[model samples]
Target: MANSLPVAVLFGVYLGIVTGIVPALVAWTLGFLFRYVVGVTIPGFGVLVLGISLAGVNGGLLALADPTIVATTDAPTIVTALLVVMMLTLYAHSRGDALGAALPRGAVAWRAIGERTLSVDLAEVFGSEVRIAVEGPVSDIEGFPPLSADTRTAIRETDWRLSADLPIDELQRRLADRIATEFDCAEVSVQIDDRGRASVAAAPELAGVSRRLDAGQRAVSVDALVPTGLVRGDRVTVRTPAETVDGTIVSARSGDPDEPSTAEPVPHSGAATTTGGEGRVTVGVSRADASRLLAVDRAAVIVRSRGRSREIELLSVLRRAGHRVRSVTLGADPPATVADLPGTVLAAETPDGWTITPAADHPLAPDQALFVVGSPETLARLGEVAR
Candidate 1:
């Protein structure tokens, strides 16, 4: 007698639950363990192989219980069983992957292991902000010169806190500026990630008067009774017995004229130092005037009164206009010239020194560095090209 439609449907459902559902559950469990515990992924083919192996085991057990059932099974029934197993296995594996990703790491381990076994947190959370801890010495990028041992030690010893709320690019710029100022670096690069981790690369300030000398200018030391409260970048006239020489003071030290000056050169500012005595002054002067100034043993110094600096005013205006400055090192394959850059080229530093506002056609080379000014987007595009 033929089976009724309802009876056949019930039988098929029972068979599916026994063969398909059971194997699928096993596959899902294995998939979850692979992802969450082993930190590995199982491919679709591997899952299919597993399902087939489980189906064969089920078939063997069923045949052992009733040999007549194996004899009665048809090609179509076997094909249907395999298809159901494959489909269910794939669905279960996918669900397992979703669950694995949703759950936190070691969630299952909490039953057997305690919270103390996990890694310590490096970030502190407060209301709306996260502060990342920064320890150890700052790292230098490959191919760039390393900072001094003292600078490395200083950076390591200081406490640094980085906020995750600020824009990363702006934060990096601010941090780089702070490091440069505090450590007297000529160039500083900072990178911060979404997790509030930071990496820094810094180059020490260039030594001596060479770094400060401009084109067509020479630095010369002159013996004179420098005025009280004199400082670097001061406009002054050296009145010698023969003639007066005009120059800007590169550095000044007020002490005994016969002794060497150990005082560091102060940055460009209107405020004068408290130093007073007969001391030597390093002055930046034109090539023609350099020789005349060198011939004199001693001269009287006259400080020239000047108005507000144009460079400072220009920089302030640029900042107010939402422009930013960035220094980039050229890669092995860089753009042909300053014209190819996306932003305005402020200056290019080569082995021969800096070229201010280089012409469009000026050639570029590997390892050369340049400063560019532009909007954040423009700078971002330029950074990719430079790298």
Candidate 2:
């Protein structure tokens, strides 16, 4: 029996080395290498746990060390152990879940976290308009969930806090670039407000525009001097740097507020054109526009090269294209015209662009429009449903 035991022990060691030790060692090594490379990534803790657990299992199966014990257990026979280990390993590899081998890695699956945005005050960035640089944390990135209808939120519970010392403007640009890469989107844009708030936006135009308007709080005015057609008292919702507020059309006047309105309209007491001599053709604006024109009569108005009127502000773009912005309001319909904006949506004018918010319950009409101030090279992409 003692001699027989010796034979069994030898057989176990042979089995362990040929099947268990070699394959298991290879598996554990592969798993360790994978985690070493990927564990440092953001939100990889779950994967890390899974990888290490798999490595440990491989190590146990391999029995690479302690050959003496393995040889003693050889009574079960090295041949059987080899056959079992080989079958298991081959089976694992075939299933494509062979984590220890590192051939089959977990795929990145994402849950859509609906997009939400915020507008920020510029007080922190600057009391007045000052271009500031923005920086973003590498850890927090744009590989967020898919575009969904749910509200997306950021929480600091499970991961480390992400912050950067980069200036607001620089950070915005950086984030824009980063998010562009993360989402494999080439059209990302980063914007930073005076208040330290930054936004990295990308996606279809409809979604992008919606996200932009809906984000945060800001102070703004409506009908800010697009063309002669827009007038003060036109009634528009004003969105401030802090929140969306209802506002009246103060003026879309161009130029200095101190200028008098009658200067151009009033010819010198007895000018040749009107009094003593031939009359000249003078185009005077309407009563409402004349009122606003009076405030800024000092500055020269630049005529657009193509259109009869041009928007000096960004909100005018949205307004021009017939796209209006409103939060979800109780009504099922949007404003029939810009005149109804004040009653339906919140809006404002900024030197850089226009800020707008819509009523949550408001249903978008085919005629509803978003007021964009400047000309954009890329057109907004709309969904089939919205279209």
273-295 per-residue lDDT for model 1 (tens digits): 73787788888999989999889
Cα-lDDT of candidate 1: 0.72
Clashes of 1: 0
Identify the leading candidate in terms of lDDT.
1
Q: Mind giving the per-residue lDDT tens digits that candidate 2 earns over 1-387?
A: 223755765664555445454444444444455543343222233433443444445545656676454445533564545455555444333333334344322221111123221223432323222333333422322554343221112111112111232334434655565445433343556566544444444542234312323223222222232334433233343222333333233324343446554444432121112111111111233344333433432322222233434444545676566443322222343334433332333543334454465444433455333532221111111111111
After superposing candidate 1, which stretches have Cα over 4 Å from the reference?
1-134, 138-165, 177-199, 205-207, 227-229, 256-274, 310-387
Every model's Cα RMSD, please?
Answer: 12.3, 21.1
lDDT of 2 at 168: 48
What is the Å distance of residue 82 in model 2 from its true position? Answer: 1.1
